[model samples]
Target: MFKIHEIREIIKLIDQSSIKEFELEIEGSKVTIKKSGGVVEEKVQTIVAQAPAAPVAAAPAPAAQAAPVQPAAQPAANTQVPEENLHQILSPMVGTFYSAPEPGASAFVQVGDKVTPNKVVCIVEAMKLFNEIEAEVTGEIVKVLVQDGQLVEYGQPLFLVKPE
Candidate 1:
């Protein structure tokens, strides 16, 4: 049987690699893990075998669910300016978005704040991994599209920026 920490370590290692599926069998227990490309959704399956004379059974594990969908509201500023002139900072992976580094802390960037290419604008936590997201461009933040702790999808726009 694999320890909790060992399982976490394995997940971390797999998360950093390009492998899509991983399976391991130890003794009479089997573990199967699967993840999508650029998305953090994970489904883990475990199966246990009984004595040689008995039959093996596989139990289906509960699947991870994405955050509840929120209705999109149009910002007044977006209507005034042409969106073609603005740049969108998209989420690179599926995860929970956090504007602040921690609870009650000031957000990394707010609307009207200037950001450079390497400036960290937020964090996207997936499968217990906190990924720092950068601005990737020099611009003034025009709008924050997602709320804190909201689940974001891959390629979804998180911020709108007006290029400096």
Candidate 2:
């Protein structure tokens, strides 16, 4: 019989190693561990695994844009104006977007909320873990680009803000 301490030690060593999966059987007592790299990657992967919709959501935009809309019809001012005044905080990785830390929790930021560069704007829940997404721009949140539980792609815009 493997003691609890021994099992823990095995897990710790397995985590530090490059092996992705581990399984062992001794006298009918079995142990299995599936690793997803180190601690930071595990946290990020926990969220990304649930965001399979990310790629689907990304497709078709370019095709649709190429159909009927003339790029020249959009004035340069309109294209540049918003970007000049507003900054967007984009997702650092693909995940399911969440406005709050947990169910029934108050959202980290709402429309018109003032935020600093390091403020936590929202939490993105991927697999079963919630990763806090921060605001990299000091500004007032003008719009939220994603809904709660929405699947977001890496670099997808989450919030648009009017920079202070």
Candidate 3:
């Protein structure tokens, strides 16, 4: 998911370049960005694969929502929502998310799976290196938020856990 900051950078790049439109497609997800009337319009569409490349869930595009642009001396509206009672396991780096250790391997955890601090919950592959991601909170996995092979940004929520 492109963060608001990333989108801003893209807009700046577009404004400084001759390109009027940009589109990127990965797997079943597509992102189309266009410039209109000094405003940037981005349409992202994603289809969740039932038998996901692995047992992972889909990546987050909706979480990339942008806040209203504000001029200098003004503050933008806060768009962040707090996940109460749910401990979130976040990605530590920008990488491709993986639910299993390797191809054809079963996933590390699923919804309803119980986990504890330091327990490996998934893998994030960065630059061909696989880094194990741990569940920091003792809890029951309530949700797996990112798909296997999905590109995830640093600090992006990967799983939601209901604390024990």
Off by over 4 Å in 2: 1-84
The deviation in Å at residue 162 for candidate 3 is 0.6
Candidate whose TM-score is highest: 1
Candidate 2's displacement at residue 98, Å, is 0.6
TM-scores, one per candidate: 0.57, 0.51, 0.51
Report lDDT (CA) for all predictions. Answer: 0.66, 0.58, 0.60
lDDT (tens digit, per residue) of candidate 2 on 18-70: 33444556775656555543332223212111111211212222211211111
Model 1, 1-164: lDDT tens per residue? 66667566555544443333456678755655555433333334463211112111332122332222333354313435577999988877666889999999999998889999999999998757899999999999988888887766556688888898
Please list all clashing residue pairs in model 1, or write none if there are none.
none
The candidate 3 region of ten consecutive residues with least summed lDDT is: 47-56
Q: What's the residue-level lDDT of 25 in candidate 3? A: 60
In Å, residue 96's CA in model 1 sits off its true spot by 0.2
Scored against the true structure, residue 124 in model 2 reaches a CA lDDT of 70
Give the per-residue Cα lDDT of candidate 2 at 4: 61
Q: Identify the candidate with maximal lDDT.
A: 1
In model 1, the worst 10-residue window by lDDT is 47-56
TM-score of 3: 0.51
